[model samples]
Target: MSEIDRNQGLARQIAKNIQDSIMQGRLSAAQRLPSEVELAERFSVSQPTVREAMKILAAKKLIQSKRGPKGGVFVSPPSLDIAAQTLHETTNWLVSLGAVGLADIVGARRSLGRLSIAAACEHAEREDHKRIEAALLELDHTEISDEDFCRLEVEFHQAVAAACPNSLLRLVMVMVNEALIPAANMISFPFRQRDKVVAMQRQVFSAILVRDAAEAISAFDTLIDYQSGIYDIALEQRTLGSRLR
Candidate 1:
């Protein structure tokens, strides 16, 4: 490989090493990484190479630099929002590049959503149930535009996922929601159709409230199947439009 390629590969390797350390809990969140000079010495690499590796880590938001004299790279603290955004952007990129498709996203959401809903049914307290109900009520408002309604739809799902006892499962739900946003935006649900969607959500909520896992999963499956049909129509429309162009 060329020198530049070699440097790029080295930087990636260094970044992976740090990422593994973080994942293995050897590098705690918010902990300062060794200085560039120290890292270069330890890795037997040039300071510039170490800086390049640090840049890779920073771009991934794995490590951030501080300002002032005490400035240094530190592991990024755990952030659900940040993680969700990263997953959203990465998923979008893959979809745009045709590396992943709507069906793959739909399948993932269907599987993960069922798990989250089941867990929520088992673990959600009355207050958690209230939050889900509130979001659903907000979604039922007739005056909201399609855009506003779509936003509420996502929020309602997120609220349900929040009731899950497992944080990791909740994060997966967030990622799935983010991945599905593009598909959701492609189909414009009429006001009447939105009402039907709200009814489906209500069914899911009702099942969860009663701790009926089978009913909840079945309702969720029906909801996903309904949405997936919309996605299929949207994809077909896009294909036809491209052919016409």
Candidate 2:
């Protein structure tokens, strides 16, 4: 019989070792973990101890279990909640540095985009492809002044980021897209300019539909470049107004 100190909340050491293995990619997403009997032997603990350790990992939302002939513990990829929390943490880190402006956020987003685009190209799913189409159709009919359009823009990007193979990278992409939607609407632009903004979204979505990752990424960059240009214009206006004052 295997020895185990059951009074303890499982073996913290055993749990940590398993957790570390997952984090270090010693185990990969969807990879099967050993059976309780196997794990008990490997960790030198009782089957109950291995069970406890698996529970700890499950509570973190890091691994999921299935049953049957094919049943076993498998690595859980990041869920939206996990992905979003990771992003929010990064955003908070930047905020700690000082007052981060729209331009600063945009720059960080562009740098992050390179990673997101690459991952999306590698892992986009069928439903994600549908998400792009749905977002675009909504935008196509949305009133120019509709806040719903802005919401769709954010939704579209979130879907795009989620398509990425790396859930962690999608997290920052979510934050950046969230950052952009509000800024995009804040400035008053000519009707033509607004149309251009809508057109660009369509362009990027189309690129994604075509499975052209390079074009999709470039389209996003062009959208940001335009936003940067507009932000600079807004700054110039503020400067002029201050001079008059």
Q: lDDT scores for all predictions? A: 0.84, 0.72
For model 2, the superposed segments whose C-alpha errors exceed 4 Å read 1-98, 142-146, 180-192
For candidate 1, list the clashing residue pairs, or say none: none
lDDT string, candidate 1, 189-215, tens digits: 531377778999999999999999999
Tens digits of per-residue lDDT, candidate 2, 177-204, equal 7754455445424222656776887777
TM-score of each: 0.80, 0.58
Residue 44 in model 1: lDDT: 82
Highest-scoring model, lDDT: 1
Model 1 lDDT, full chain set: 0.84
Residue-level lDDT for 63 in candidate 1: 90
Worst 10 residues of 2 by lDDT: 183-192
